[model samples]
Target: MVVIDINKKYPEIWEFLAEVPDPEIPIINLVELGVVRNVEKEGDKVIVTITPTYTGCPAKKLFEDLIREKLIEKGFEDVQIDTTLSPAWNTDWLSEATKAKMMADGISPPTDDNKVVTCPNCKSTNTKIISKFGSTPCQSFHSCNDCLEPFNYFKCHR
Candidate 1:
């Protein structure tokens, strides 16, 4: 295990992690997606705490592998990843900027109040869910009545 000066290496570590894209949603990195919970240095080892977006999210393993690969590539020999299930993830954890980006990318983020789903293409409230499940369990299929465009809505995890 190599001794690392945290003060000097912390920023670089975080920056690299921030650049690791989410497997399912390539557009947003793990940091912006709010899956990365905490980072700490313990005795020459780097420990990263992460929370899965959902209990059985298929991307969990890929996320861990990617994180490990990234840290190893960055010369962190002893890397520890801690998966925390407590205080399970919530859609509210997502940043406003990320939500906006999701909408812009043709995926409508869940409405906080569970109101009518909006169409990302036309910004219309006349949208109906075509299916409760979309490409993934965390998403649902919806179509805009006005624009006749189908889209995915990132379901809100309460």
Candidate 2:
């Protein structure tokens, strides 16, 4: 890769980063998870800003490391990863396409409104929370009363 104006290569950088999947949620890429907030270049250093799904999330550090490694592998030697909490990360930041992908993968995506969480298995609104936390901190365990199927619901973050 020729070292030139970084602004001109923003799209290419983003496209490359899109291939890196979330360590926990392999079904969705890091971009789809809204983990990657921004990418910028200053001098010869490329800075990447990411927001964790929750405060104190263990995977935050892993995300930073992975991002830095990926950029380095892409020939961006002076890569810097920045963790930002200013705007904060909310499930609402997730796009509709991401939600649909999660639902298709049998993981209920987080919702902005306090509406009933539809079961991914049967699309039933008759679901009860089995636990506030699921396999991961960002998810909750829920079982559908209609289908009697247990599934993980991505908890809404504010």
Estimate every model's Cα lDDT from 0 to 1: 0.84, 0.83
Output the lDDT of residue 70, model 1: 96
Where is model 1 more than 4 Å wrong at Cα?
A: 1-9
Window of ten residues with lowest summed lDDT in model 2: 1-10
Clashing pairs in 2: none
TM-scores vs. true structure, each candidate: 0.90, 0.89
lDDT of 1 by residue, 29-130 (tens): 997787887788998799998889877899999999999999999888899999988667778777789989898888898786557788999999998889
lDDT of prediction 2: 0.83
lDDT of 2 by residue, 1-158 (tens): 11122243588889878888889988888877877878989988998888788887889888988888888898999998888876767777677899999999899888755367889999998899999888988999999999999999999876
Give the Cα error of residue 78 in candidate 1, in Å: 1.4
Clashing pairs in 1: none
